[model samples]
Target: MNELSLPTSTEAAIRRVEELGEALKQNFPEYVFPVEHSLHGGMYARTIRMPAGTAAVGTLIRVPTLLIVSGHVRINSGDRVYELQGYHVLEGEINRKQMAWALEDTEITMIFATQAKTVDEAEREFTVEFEQLQNRKKEISA
Candidate 1:
């Protein structure tokens, strides 16, 4: 399978990432991840910045999203693993939870198709995932 098309929503994948996330929390300092949001036309984009050595575990995305990862990182997506750098984009992925470690300061952005006018509305639309990340820095629309 290609980078964009991966086996998702498998129970094993979500569990493995959850374990990684817990390990990261215990090993690293508390980080309030910063996110930037943008909305235009029918798309909503959310960008997150992860400093080197920090890791993040994502919630299952309810909608198909375009993922752009910039900088160096290792991503464990259940049964597969990837080490990516310098602006790579993965698309057509839905219902997946991912675990990523930033080898360098990294930025990950996910774009979704939506009619939401504000960040609040977008969260409301995709409540399942965003609720899991509510502890992060306040959502800032760009």
Candidate 2:
């Protein structure tokens, strides 16, 4: 209805999304969507490769980030469900959790403008619970 609904209730939406993510993790095998990181010219890009039909959930974004969606996917998000295709690029101030199913093999990249010199620094800059969940993800997925 309204374009990019800003989560009817931020906390409620967050809890709902996180609950779904946890349930998916508990019910299904861990689907490892390989993540690639690169830093260049005052910017950082985190690219995730997701297989078709697989689902994923993302953390809260701490800042304005650039989201580039390649291939086809349906993101049933906290605010709305976005069916995106091709190489769509948008700068978003995303503030909640994500639940996405890849319609086709997909590449989703989050680019950030950063002065940080290392990937670790850039991640800490953008992520809310870098030490808690993000690091744990790297460990589990590695």
Candidate 3:
């Protein structure tokens, strides 16, 4: 007879991601959510631009089982570059980065997780949200 072994930490991380994804879908039924994953010890970055003369605000929430290096940038005065914020987080860590900017600007969010398990977990969580969003879109189009 073979004895069953408990899941390692990586498997636990993946399971946590799945749980979070379901929670997001149940809680936020109005907005489209996209989740994505990348390799461990890699970088994740994004930049968004708002229309001229408008202001924008954004938020990022990371779970406690992943490591991340995060930062943001704001463009002001039409050629001046400013670093808005930056920080790092490891497992059992929780942090929030928020920004408000004006005058036709761009903001960027970057994350780097230091383990393959972390990336895989993120990917799983994202897949759940993406599927829900796609279904919503289809309903709207129909």
Candidate 4:
């Protein structure tokens, strides 16, 4: 999908990101003002929780399309971290090592990127699978 096809939902995505930030603040009081950012093509919000030895923990929410990639992490080194197993709207769980940083006591920095191509590919696959299911159902029903 191109920009022109997604103009209306872009505003909704921004609003959702803002609302998500507010919710995180209210829910995770121990975490300081979570860093929130909206780039030209995508939006991201993250909050950091520092609990001594094992670096800081962060919860990140990102809109990479209609697919909302939300997950948590434990930042070990300066720029290295482990993405805790969790859910994204489209990919479900991307449990892997990802990069993150601590800006200060009150904020943590995270990078967000668009997954438009991935989303498109998954949609196409789902469409094909769905058609196959429909045909099977028709044969069985007949």
Candidate 5:
């Protein structure tokens, strides 16, 4: 049996995510992760649509989250690469960067834990992941 493996090192994962994000951005300039709903206090969900043949990279999340993918996608979750189609769900602790390619037009919903009082606050939380990772790197370098 052939088992698919993914990049497991932190540095390699980060680099891959950065490259994937840039490539995706160049191809899908209008791609955006908008909040889809709030799941009770300190929890929120956001969704992004990836056109077929496009890919996206995600920042390191400090907390565990749920990922629901609609349509076909190939995903690298730092430890494994999964090829999924139709409606699929992934839930785990996602403290490392990840990348995904849309085999078909895909809508991905990410549900995460946060301490935000409103959608704006939750969005801010989402944007700060990269900064947090950067700070961690700086601390390691110093």
Candidate 6:
């Protein structure tokens, strides 16, 4: 069997998130609310809480973000799925799309770094349109 490798590009991540969000909505409709807040250091964190057996999907801005899991969750990102329990933190350059399946009553938080002054501004900076990200990616690659 081939290992599922995470997509290396932000464009692929954005596409993956959309696909997963659709599937999750059809299969687990109850766990889709995300509450976001701005923190110091131009950072923002979005939290999603769900009951056991429910799942949720989230998309990220192009910035590197932190993942904080409280309780138990099975996270599926890129081409891989993994489980975490209790309180844990993972930091990395995540794809634009991410999803979590609740193994227990779980709360997952995504922390983003941004310079925006308000929650709305932070959200706008964090969730830039896919087309813009794609264009920026192209410019960077070129």
**Top lDDT model:** 1
Give the per-residue lDDT digits (tens) of candidate 1, residues 39-123: 9999999888999988787777777777888999988765888899898888646678887889999999888899998887886
- Give lDDT tens digits, candidate 5, residues 49-114: 788886666766655667788999999866467898998767645456788888998898878888
lDDT against the true structure, each candidate? 0.77, 0.76, 0.35, 0.32, 0.68, 0.63
Candidate 2: clashing pairs of residues: none
| lDDT-better candidate, 2 vs 5 | 2
Off by over 4 Å in 3: 1-41, 63-93, 114-142
Per-candidate TM vs. native? 0.84, 0.84, 0.31, 0.24, 0.68, 0.69
TM-score of 2: 0.84
Model 4 TM-score, all chains together: 0.24
> Can you write out model 4's per-residue Cα lDDT over 54-88, one digit (the tens) per residue?
22222222223333333443322222223433432
Rank order (by lDDT, best first): 1, 2, 5, 6, 3, 4
Off by over 4 Å in 6: 1-17, 27-36, 129-142
In model 3, state the lDDT of residue 16: 45
> How many residue-pair clashes does candidate 3 contain?
1
lDDT score of residue 81 within candidate 5:
74
Off by over 4 Å in 1: 1-6, 134-142
Cα lDDT tens digits for candidate 6, 44-142: 776766788876655454666677789988876566677778987776464356667788888867687777777657656666653333323444668
For candidate 3, give the lDDT. Answer: 0.35
Q: On a 0 to 100 scale, what is the lDDT of residue 65 in model 2?
A: 72
Best by TM-score: 1
* Candidate rank order under TM-score: 1, 2, 6, 5, 3, 4
Against the true structure, candidate 5 has what lDDT?
Answer: 0.68
1 or 6: which has the higher TM-score?
1
